[model samples]
Target: MRNLRQKQASLVHRPIAWHVTHWSHDVYSQGAYSTLLPGGSPAHRAALGDCLDGRLVIAGEACNPKAPAMVHGAWDDGIRAANLAVRAGARRVIVIGAGCAGLGAARHLSAQGIDCVVLEARERIGGRTHSLQLGPVTVDVGAAWLQQFGDNAVAREAERLGVRLVGTDFSQPLAAASDGPVDGIEAAWEALRRGIDRRLPLTEGVARYLAGLAPAEARATRYAIEGNLIIEACLPLAELSVDSLDEEGVGNDDHFLPGGYRQVIDHLAAGLDIRLGQPVARIDWQGSDVRVNDALGDFCICTVPLGVLKTLQFVPELPQPQRDALAHLGMGRLEKVVLQFDRRWWPRSPTGYLRWYDTPASWVEWLDLTDAVGTPTVAGLIAADAVERQFSGRSDEEIALAARDALQAWACAVEAVR
Candidate 1:
């Protein structure tokens, strides 16, 4: 357990005790789960195994390694799983969960002339990519940006669906610590470019080492460069299996869509049969045909999130290896706070503001969203742990106040620039 001071220090802004308690109460009331399991991986499938009586198969983004934790990645996996099940002669397939994965599965199955019934627990579709209206403007509470969109299926699908693509303006000026202008913003960008360049050789070297091919097979320097790229992505080059890298490297550069990412899910859900407000409570796979029970009639999907499956009681129990793998597969937590400002207060240079505070409770990075949206009414502040804590016990007023202070400081810094 972290001490109050330590916890406060970790936040982007010092949170009041009352706010913390209030946030905690809100979390409990909402039944929000803090621990995350990486969505979109095979861990769920492995855990469920052949328990689905050969009639049921699980497929979702969580089952794919390369696309783990991504919306389109999950959708692609869902489609593949549905296709596999259809080929196996399963009739009247059911898709559990109406998120991107489920919708993707439904869409693909529909295209292939397969019948699929989608069950969504929420009133609307799009799972984690949800949009909410704030003061006459609809904002994304979930996935906002498409990341690298061109290479992404969601981006392509969005384009096909007439969803507009917007490029993020990276030309905004940035402010640094203590409400000071970041003099090194340009230098930092140059250094980052150089770092990436420097890392390429290292990546290539590691790739060669794993392939067991002679350094002469590819320039040793090239292997080193590739190895460094892998490392930068948080995967160690030496430990990365060649097969895994080959599979994972399929799509690297993708674009982000404007409006909201949820549009893709909505588009996918259109024309598909979906039962909303239905949550699957249990799964009985002992029978020849798998059964899933919710408020609505029981239906089965080939795949479910490992997090959901882990809590579910399996009569025969899961295999040890599968269970262990599920346990080991970690999930990352990301929170986005969109601050609606009265006006654009930050610097307008290409390099945006990034602040590092001596205190733990200050925001680490703030980005200008003015260009993404027509108005300068919104800015995004990202502080991982602090934001998580903020969700615990703080009131909306308190959270807003803290955000205001942080933004005010940043605004001051921006104004200081000539």
Candidate 2:
């Protein structure tokens, strides 16, 4: 036992406490967010949001073409679904999947004197936007950043709730305790992508681009692409489209709600009729009235994630457009690991990002939350193949060990280089 303990200690240092998100394995979520496949277009997203038979509407982040995979988009689409349901003469609504979208729909419908019943699979209402009190400070295990702050309703709600929104300048990442290089590689990517057929899956296109390069240069560029672009897409390059690069880009500044992002979801859910631990086994939309389990309503707005929606049983089936959209659109995996130390083990300044380009690249980029939460915490994200390869089937302790080892190895490499 003593030798085993010593071996473990030598392998890696441990944090006081840690949390990891197994989103892909979650039956309710099945994925972190939505993404377009090789042939899917933005119109597919619009199609997914379309009202079915004027009595049923599918609304969620995946449905919002303007900003799919965003909290504001999910919230906005939920409100949109509610308005459409009212227009269709719905006085009572059954909102499925008590996520941001369901909460948004319920909030809108209830305000308009429409009776709304929200059924959530999980005990929590936030869905993938859950918040947890890790150690001394709160950490968002799901969605954290308030993107496109200027037009984001989520951000606006945060401010109204008196939550502090801290601006993050991602351009100034603290790498090795110094401002890292900010060479926007769009120019290089364009040169590589210039003549390649855009319809090819991102991997094929990337392969063709890298094929001509020398071995070392190709490896370095590939590493950058994996760390930056692949991480952004949250899916394997083979499943992702070349358009992902353009589709994933967000304009305007993103703010971090250090006060906890769950506040916005809670505010949206306040005073609403939400039933937790009630998963809709089936949604029968065969007639004018849609039935969700024991509850039946004139209209049902399903905000269940695309990942879950694919597995959900809908009687008589959804429309061709919705079915087609679901077929073409894909869900992307994004998993997070939050490590809280007894004290700050990293820098407090820059407070944005710390990236490591080492081999394996499992926990390559991390968000420094030490400054935001006033606690010594760092969150690292792994997506796509990294999630499946390194994290799947691994125990939480083992995953935590992997991350600590990666960080330890990175620090040692930096010191050796110095």
Candidate 3:
């Protein structure tokens, strides 16, 4: 058997990076689950959460047209459902799926002196807001950060719960796989911004749109484009929508709760009845009466995921248009890979986000978790279509190996700059 020293020596000399490191992957089937595929357009939103015969009301991020796939969107939908329930004279509310949206609805209804029963298919609440143990430290597996402070429900709840938050550094730190760190990448980024400013109605995607610009051939420009368009948006350049870019008004004040996002889940779960391990099979509703198994109520609010709801049985069947909307609106695929290292191998910069321009895979943007989690850890968040093609069916080991190899290349590239 090779000793640790021998193993370390072999790894160093294997044309990889410096010292060998051991890492573990914690993968979830619906990890960072978001509906990013087709469906859920404006036409679909009309029936997404509409009350059917004043007996069934749908809720969740899927119902939110303004901010789908966001925790805040789900939270807001819960509030809307609570109001709808009160207006409909619901004696007791049945909230399906104890996710952020469901819990939010239950919590608000409870506060309003209304009664609600929340049924969760999974054993725990906080649907996508899952936090898991990674080696020695704990990290969020889903819904990690509060995007902004301005009127953000997540941030407000965090403050109320007294959950301390650490602001994530969004400063750009650019590096290329073949050329290492590009020292003057910001200048190129500013030039690209100038070009973007000049192009008013950008119909095409960022990658092609930038390519049409004069100086897009510069290596630094591509780095900037990858970091800004691809990595930041979590989508490929071609798929990123330039039209909705201006619609985002939330200033860059994103933060992560070090105490774990589960704290938020616990806070929202207080004083609410949540039945765990109870998978809802079907919804039978008519004329202000809803039933799921023996759990009967005057009205039902479905906070279940679109993906999960699509598979469930609905009695009397929903309208064809509603079915079509549910069929078309897709769940966007967003996955995260977290690796805990023995020590910090990458450069210690104030930059929070690092992007590798030359990497073809989705592990392009890496979030350094050393400062936040107090571990020599890094988490890679991939949101491009390539994620589905590359990582969908692969096991945790396969994905981790891919991540390790990518990190190996990235470390070598960053090390060369030093």
Candidate 4:
């Protein structure tokens, strides 16, 4: 048999700087985003956010059905929760988990002449929308992209906040792997997916759509599936629901925050009462007023991520539907490893994604952030089982090495084609 060493041959060029995230291991997030199970329903998200006892509500990306697992969704849900609190005659409100949702809720509640305070377990605000300074530039380590930017609320917010954004064009074709000559692929892919059997997983749906694709088209379709869909879902396709394929965000433009996404977080957090380093241990909500830790409020909005919510203690336990919502959904891991070399070494691509389809492990997808972040940097994205293996205690330098090896493999493949 051919030696498996060929599968992950290492490159000699060492990176000067590196950053990797283990959102799953994070005590705050637990995982990067909410995972849509094979046969999950948006109703479950509704159930999760359902207001209880007219004094408690859950708010987060997981609570927004139209746009779950999105930063704007969390922010929007927080605002929605704040409105609900106002309508319910809440005098004072306590918002849990100072993420986009919490900050958004606090901002809205404070504006509405209501007394509100936000409790955060982390030392800083922004939560999942985090940024880190690397060399001379600031890049987002948490939620980075302003997806579907044209109508994205965060995109508009970025503009008002003066945060710089660089557009991503994935179809530039220089760095991406095979799966060529598939015209109308996006519309075609969506059309075929519209009637996917609901009982089965997304893998089955993809299989049905790819039943008799041409050799070239099949390759490209698989690349798109593995590089785009799988990466977005943050789970192996088999674990995703066919329904996930049915939904698409309204717009198409995806932009990176050149100055980092924290600009939005900082803007929303301004003029709000937020308490940091206060982890909520239990919520006692059986009385007329809800009690979260030592803070009590006429109403409470819990914006905790779904992964953390599963283990959080609630007094009298959540209703059956909410508990069932927690049981039905799952959290999928998506992490990034940033590798900055002394100089640009790999083949250049238009500012977008470089997907190496030859091997779908480690760095299956890479975002060329050189132009976006103004440094010789590339962000390698890994998901699903890759997350488990990396976070099991792998160091950032080791992850950088593995990512560099994948870049070597991609370079070799590109040379062969030329």
Candidate 4 Cα outliers beyond 4 Å, as residue runs = 1-11, 171-196, 203-221, 249-251, 389-393
- The global C-alpha lDDT for each of the candidates, from Candidate 1 onward, is 0.50, 0.79, 0.66, 0.77
Ranking by lDDT: 2, 4, 3, 1
Off by over 4 Å in 2: 1-12, 175-196, 214-217, 249-251, 347-349, 414-418
In angstroms, the error of model 2 at 10 is 7.7
**Model 2, poorest ten-residue lDDT window?**
175-184
Compared with the true structure, model 1 gives a TM-score of: 0.67
lDDT tens per residue, model 2, 313-372: 889888888899998788888888998887765444454576666545577678878878
Error of 2 at 341 (Å): 1.0
**Candidate 3, which ten residues in sequence have the lowest lDDT sum?**
15-24
Each prediction's RMSD over C-alphas, in Å, is: 9.7, 4.2, 6.1, 3.2
The TM-scores, one per candidate, come to 0.67, 0.91, 0.79, 0.90
Residue-wise C-alpha lDDT for candidate 3, range 1-418, written one tens digit per residue: 1342243334421211111111112121232333333212444654677877777888887787666657788898888888898888888999988888898889888888887899888787888778877766678877777875565797898898788888876655545454444555667666666566324333243455566756534666666655554444444544434432322311267788776788888877987999998887789885457888779899889887776777678887987767876764544445677877777776665765666655455566677878887878777766556476557577766776666656666666665556
Q: Model 1, range 1-418, lDDT digits (tens) per residue?
A: 1343343344353322111112112221121111222231344434533324445555555466546546666677777767666667766667777877788778877887776788776677776667765543556665555644555677777778888775554333354344232343434333333433233343453443436533343233232222222211223333322222223321244344546676676667789998887666565656555555532222356344545545666545555655655564433233445666555555564633344332343444455555665555443343334555545576666666666566656555444445
Sliding window of 10 residues with minimal summed lDDT for model 1:
27-36
